[model samples]
Target: MITNDTMQASSQGAQKVILTIAAAIILFATFENKMPGGMIGALGAMAIIGFVLNYIGDRTPIISQFFGGGAIVVIFGSSYLFHKGIFPTETADQITTFMKSGGFLAFYVASLVTGSIFGMSTQTLKKAALKYIPVILGSAAVACLLTGLVGMLVGKSFYDAVMLIALPIMGGGMGAGAVPLVQIMSGKTGMDAQTLMSQMVPALAIGNAIAIVMAGLLNKLGQVMPSLTGNGELIRGATAEVESEEKEAAVDLKMLAIGALLAISMFFFGTLLSMVIPMHPYALMIISIALIKVSGLMPKAFEQAAHAWYKFVVGNLTPALLVGIGVAYTNLDQIIAALTPMYFVLVFVTVLGAVIGAGLIGRMMGFYPIEAAITGGLCMANMGGTGDVAVLAASRRMKLMPFAQISSRIGGAFMLILATLVVQAIA
Candidate 1:
């Protein structure tokens, strides 16, 4: 007779086979244009496609070792599929509509931000706030200097290089960085905002792609030079008090629901406050959450719930979100149209400078070099909130979400101010 252990193994193997066959059937149906319609069809298609790409990337040798495994593959692969019309049109449109109009990206990030802030120790949070801005500044400074110098070598002016390429690359993302930046430059230089946008969009796109790859490389470098990283931790000498707390905290379905509600409520509050704050809703939400955490006002149960909710969302939805990012946000044609040897080099140098500058300064401020660089440098170079998620996920440092948001929202706001001054000076 078969033993209990053997019986369990056989059962698991059977379950896997059944799931695989079901997945194959769904995918085949999808390809044949017979998939279900609306949200079910869209989500099913994205989840299935994303899971397969993620699995391949994770198992592929070089990709698993250095290119962010499934995160990279899900993003780039989805983009390619969407571009080639391989994804069903109805499903693709639904995914895009869900990501953009349905507010899935914001919903996802709000959970992370709320949960992450609640999960951190007050001391670590305070220290990070103190040191993070300077790191962003250092990264931006070095990136601008390097990109401008390279621009001169490429027959472009220093101002154009810094203002057009470096600033936009480091300015957060398109809406927060390039759009307002174009308007500011237009007012200063008498050029149309649309014209300025055309010049800056390519730089933003290329820079974001480079930042993602660099995040993966940095993760690999951390593995090779373990001392330079804290694995997922940001602060160098900080104890794992949060992790211990998480282990001790009790979780249930009620707690998870509470956490979800708290996350969305904070986001709503942020939107309400934006009327008076003159900042991004995400920035306001972060500030609000940070203040609440620092004040010790929220109940311990609620905090634990929020953190648990965050963990749940991240574990279950990251790949799906990346799929949405690729199909909804990425522009293959724009990236290809902007490709040129000198331009690529300039973009690469800008991102490289950000990593170097942030890493060095972050180490000085008692943060792990790799963690600091990924948050302060790569986040700024990415496409705002979405880029932050992609980069942090690629680096396998999801716990650093709080710091990454600070870079995108707060650092991005700082860039807008800097652009104003630079435009006036250069124009």
Candidate 2:
């Protein structure tokens, strides 16, 4: 004589029991080093660990409110775990290899970039494109100015402050931003690349950490001052158009497969183009997608399919991706070593300046201040792709992936060029 509500409760309880049992088994296998090799074991371990940390982070009082909730927890928690030898060596190695050689991050980003760009209305894309670069430039300029002035005040040279500290902080990430700048500066100044790297690495690490925290703070600011943010939207007055474009459709298994294929194909084409273009594949992919969207060449159904695929990946894999990032990219030691009071202040000001400058310029160009700051400012200040994911996830603004990519890839290229010019002038 059980009613429908009772039956539903019973069903839910049973599902929870089943899920708990599965998670327990995975944990046991992972700890015992008995898990299967390859993607199956790696993904299972990441999902279980990531989900548990995420749950705890989301409910942890002030952390859930001001910090990045589960996103930040997953990152720092996983890094701490890995650093402290809590995560099994085999398990750690597996996650690292999977993230890097396995190319999971790239795969995830490809889906996001393809789907997000396709999901937007051509009009919105065009409008945003025309205004986005200016915001990036404004952010970098202010960050450099602020950090340089602070350096001079602290008895450091303005050249070192701007070129070594501030420039690397806004250069994108380690590989694309700092590394290239180091090479360029070393070539111009006749300094060893290793020495240049030693200086730049700490700045990149500290800057990335500040950018993540700032993202969370900005998210909280948006909550407190609703007028400053469009929630996740970047451009203003385009909500109606974006909403219309984002209207969900019934997506079948075949359509999802099609969407996945399309995303991968776009990434593949971008990779192919990069060989000749001397630009990042991501930038090329974004440009190609934008052109396609603007030309009205892609069919409506395919666009819907791509968007569906993006939604699926974002909904299911984000926490796991964060775990991968934590284990693979975050260097707790580097961050710890760079925690001097003065050094920390410089990095903080650099990121803060980027946020403020980008937000102000973005507002002037019809963009939401918070959203603009997160994408153009914070993304530029972060460690590139991984940083973009971490910051965006922290801010709970995953829909802005396209713009974040632009900040990381296109904006990063601009920094490299600027670094080249500055190095030549100084030399």
Candidate 3:
């Protein structure tokens, strides 16, 4: 007896409730006792959730349509609530400072750059991505380990100082992965990290465009290359293929300026809210993103900007910063103890929920398989980046090029705000 509009309305309401709960949980964990070590437990949970979700995405092609990169942001917001909810408040100044500076701005840039660069010149990078994906990912793992070791070893900085670098690395790694690794090794300042991430928006937008181009090239290759066609229909074989169609980019300079102004405005409003509502500094960002999205002007902005400053930074940057800030001030060991035990259960289940739900929705709505896969890919990558996209792509056997590029930026501007609210709920 439920109508589609009613169902959608219910879904929206549920999202709001879920976000509030997650924020409450993250806040509670912060207050009850101190988190020690890294947010190892929570992060590990995120990793597993990330892995499982991508795996599901690859396997269930139809669902990918809706699950695309959006799922990634969605997963973190929800997970933060269920697992990290032992405490009830997130008003710790240390956590806020850690997040606001390092992770906050850095992630924004990383997603945007990755998206834009990939979006425009989809061709060249796909070749490079095919060649270097293995190395790139491995380098990423090694980079994470090395960064952690170096940070721990230099050990010269107190909690306050270490965070300046730590949060940036975490945010950057979560987005572009390897680039941030190099930046730190080169002795760049943390401010450099934020600037680098901001620049990443355009770079990746170009890269994403390239990815779209690559999908076309690969489609041609599919005509000549291998096929698993029992039906022998040639192009539309068993292999799941997703090619992004290029529309006129609604990219606009004016909209970019507006979105930026809105974000800054939200920052100020959030500051005001912090006094009365106890919101975090980045809360403004989340709220700003939501307002932009609900208003639905993002597409116009994208085309207006010529795909220049697309909104990758929102979901990814904000959460990475929030979690990074929390991690910066927090002791990893204690967090490991508090949250790790629940990792496997929480991570897997939530991912399963998204994959199953999004996939079903995509298929029921008659979306193509690859589209469904990209939809699910969002569960991990929207805020996180290549790690999430790569995992889903490989698992789904998708042409990572166009899907990765277009999918990341699709609904991108708004997802950031939605993701932040969800993450804040966890906090």
Candidate 4:
């Protein structure tokens, strides 16, 4: 009884469903005795899982509104599955190997760091660069102080509060924050590095959860108090001066390839700089890209190409990368183990400190309070690269990535320095 068009539509939809099931079956097979053949298997599994979670999160009403859609869901859901032994051990191990040693995370971040910086308007870069650091520092100061106070009130020493809770929360997630911190603390205190790391890991995980959820809440807050947000714009009144539209860059496959080349080259350049200087490659990469952006070193067409590539990557790859994050980085077992009344209180206070501190100073600097709090504060509070993306995506402010990176990289470094000082004093 159906017309020709209806039959075609039904056929196509059925094909899509079949394709999804086939992919899912292939992914599951990769878990069977033999190792899934490397990148292809890993990416296919991540894509299938990530998109499914993304769909579930989007379709759910209230959760989507306040929790920033599928990011949190994907992370938690993947972790739960892993913890519950739903994902086979071999499969989980493969995903982890791909994420860490295979450099999936770095590859993903490099594209974002390169494209976002190059795509930004010069004036916005200049204005934001000059003013953003103080906002980060303010958030850090308040976060540490508040956490320290809360710990003391709960009968924990001020050092335990700041070092264990506050530092990890503000330290920028696992790679940039906890790993380096454990090394530094172990050297200073003669504690086993693994032991120190175990203590700090909970704070980082819990803090990341709080930050992601808070980002959604802050987005809603911005809407209720319209004056407090420039929507995705970080600076108030600065949006008018900036040409922030993505529509101008026509979608071209050649341009996308050029963009990928530019991003990878920039990442390598940062890696090269890291050899001569003792800084993270990402920080150097940010500095290098920002300098070129402000100096007008690249041509307009090059910039446009980079922007186009960034659009392609962000649009196409974010869900898959997030799935990689869930399968690899998020450890729900650790998070669950770390939950305690005092621990929860301290983490909550630290996030609260960031919101209050960044919000006040951001308002003073003519930035929307909600935007500032989320990017400067919550981004610092979340897990490093993935956390920044999750938090910003939840807030619908992906454009604020540059500032969020600043918080995670530079601000995380600052936290490390402070932790060293705090540990020295304690010792």
Candidate 5:
């Protein structure tokens, strides 16, 4: 028996949500032809677009079960919008500019890295460090070989297939993986930057899509074969007794704000170190944060704050960040134009190679095969930061962000170096 007041309040809430969405759309439309600046215009459009895609993905059955819901939807949907020219050029450009120069992706990664690492116990971190690096190296090697073999079978040259198809897919993500690889190739092979990007970007986009789908499939595999997963625990035989007793603090505005500051501060520290180290800021950040976590020096209050902030950001900002990726990073035209049976088969093989290699090595290292493949292998093959979140979500293992980041950042750098050497040898 619902009262009139309750019904009225429900109606009001629904109206508010609709009004907010409508307002966001209006703002996007207003700036359709103008290069809008600041978070208000660019981030606002992304939020609205991402929310709609997320909602649609969740309600859709096949997509939810097989493709990890909103993440895939947001990428493909935004790509569609851009492909059809439905999203105006100016609006799309604004989103891309913000994602790149405004450091939206950096901000998102920084928050997750800082919060997630601090929230974990020192013991789990230590156990993870022992076995994770092997999984990354093994996956990269396997993926490259399989993709190269498949390329030859499909009548393509081994170098082109490995460099253009396999390497990009396995290289981590766009900023850290594909973009840098393009520059390296252009310098060594005398290929135009645009030509190299044209070939590699599609592999990344399609590989990311497959990785997300494979994540969901792997999650299902875990259920059918329970022994193949640690059920969100990365370390084999790491007892849950200590972690189960740990309580999550009630999320509050103050705690969230504090968490935000901590995340940003750590990101700044990582950037500062990168000045001398010549590594990606994210790689430095991951190493620095892990040391801080393993050292047992962060205050409990600060740890809680980081944990709370990670939750808030992951829950609220993921879709927005994904929208930024689709608009700024994904090029639907390139992906579609590059589609062919051989290309498709090669991409599939690259992803499969990663899973097989990671699964085998992970089992040897005492990790669940399915979880290892998803985090260490698939996370590596997918587009960097956004792909990590999507694959983990699809596998229902958000707790593995630390390892996933390592796979993306450090592992990506490894691939870049490998590509450089390979090019030099062949040239």
Candidate 6:
């Protein structure tokens, strides 16, 4: 018989294997049912992106950052345009029929809801739903304003449907979640309903992918950015909103409970209120911040729960989200002629602009180069989504994790809102 320690080690190894197997099973089972086509395509896409990223990352960092996105845009955007007859479409009726189907509609909505749900980084039960508001709301508002302008410029009707994709890419895609708000203009009081719906689906897919990549790229940049956000974990007031190094210490049951309550309240209120207010999340964020503030008011305010709550509100959704994205995008080759060039232009200009803008904005707020750069990249990612941000952030080895995530998410909400407006106007 084996010694006691050997037995323990064997058991431990078995448990680890079991856990890995379980994780895989859960992932496939979830994807098999929830996402159409399957996760194979999704995994494939990630692999392709990863391989290309690896190669390019070693040579030209910035180029690698924007490389994959262009292809997504071309395939999805072209298919959408052809379906809508904006381009030379084959069997426009079929395209329309497929796009307008309930299955496609459900897919889009499910992805959105899941992305939102899985993205939440909270521990409290209630705070789960509320977590999506500020970002989404900001996304909606900014989208609306821009949409109105685009609509005004593009003659504002069904003919302008293709523009929705612009917002998704512009926001780095995760923030492109706001594209659904394009439906706002499709209502009885909104623009042509069919037109808006047609473009929104693809925008959701492509944009989210872009967002993921943007996140990655931003993280990569932080690895190379001049060190600046490396300040010590000073005695930050123990708030429920703490995102600093002390997050581990700040987590606890009470804070989690509070976060859950807040998230739930926000979702309930957001849904309830979306009916009445155009600028929906204004109240949501203000209230979330207020509550987050309240939770931190006492001694153990955000002690442990802050981190826990954040996890509940926004963590571990990337794989599924990406898989869903990959499954739907069938035409990989077309990406070259279709999406990359424009996406490259957009990302380059936007990054350059954000860098300049963040510098100005940072000076005003008293942050440093790395802090501002990471934050600016984060804004780009969230406005774009996680994939893009992740790709951007991870492009380098010594990435600034926290700053990149926080800033991108924060900026994502705002940028997406702007994107929505621009998209709606065009749609």
lDDT tens digits, residues 1-427, model 6? 7899999999999998996675565445333433223334333333333333233343554444543333333333433533444422322232233333413322322223222222223332133224322332333333334443444454544223224443443343432344444444445335575666454444444343444454344444444663433221111121233344232444567766765554445446545654776533323433343354445442344323433564543233322223223333323333333354444333333333444445444434444443444344334433333343233323331122233333334444454455456545655
Reference-based TM-score of each model = 0.96, 0.98, 0.28, 0.93, 0.90, 0.47
Which sequence of candidate numbers ranks them by TM-score, best first? Answer: 2, 1, 4, 5, 6, 3
- Write one digit per residue (lDDT tens) for candidate 1, span 1-427: 9999999999999999998998898788778778777667767777888889888989999988998988999899999998788867766787898888888899999999999899888878888888888899988888999999999999999988988899998998998899988888988888888888988999998888889888899999999999999998888877676555555477799999999999999999999999998988998999999999999999988998999999999998899899999998888889989999988999999999999889989999899999989999999899998899889888999888888988998888888899998877777
Question: Model 5 — TM-score against the truth?
Answer: 0.90
For model 5, the stretches where C-alpha displacement exceeds 4 angstroms are 1-37, 186-194
Instruction: Please give the distance, in angstroms, between residue 266's alpha carbon in candidate 3 and its true position after superposition.
Output: 8.1
lDDT of 4 by residue, 1-427 (tens): 8899999999999999998788668656754635466898877777777777888987799878777778778777877776578778777887888888988878888888888888777887888887888899989999999999889999998888888788988998887899989988898887899888888888988888889888888887877789889998888887766755433667688888998999899989999999999888888999999999889889888888888887777787777787777777777878878889988999999999998888888888778888889888998899898898888877878767778888999999999998888788878
Tell me how far candidate 5 lies from the true structure as C-alpha RMSD in angstroms: 2.9
**For candidate 2, lDDT tens digit of each residue in 58-80?**
99988889988999899989988
Candidate 4 shows a clash count of 0
Worst 10 residues of 4 by lDDT: 27-36
lDDT ranking, best first: 2, 1, 5, 4, 6, 3
Q: Indicate the TM-score of model 2.
A: 0.98
Which candidate comes out best when scored by TM-score? Answer: 2
Better model by lDDT: candidate 1 vs candidate 5: 1
Candidate 3: minimum summed lDDT over ten consecutive residues — where?
228-237
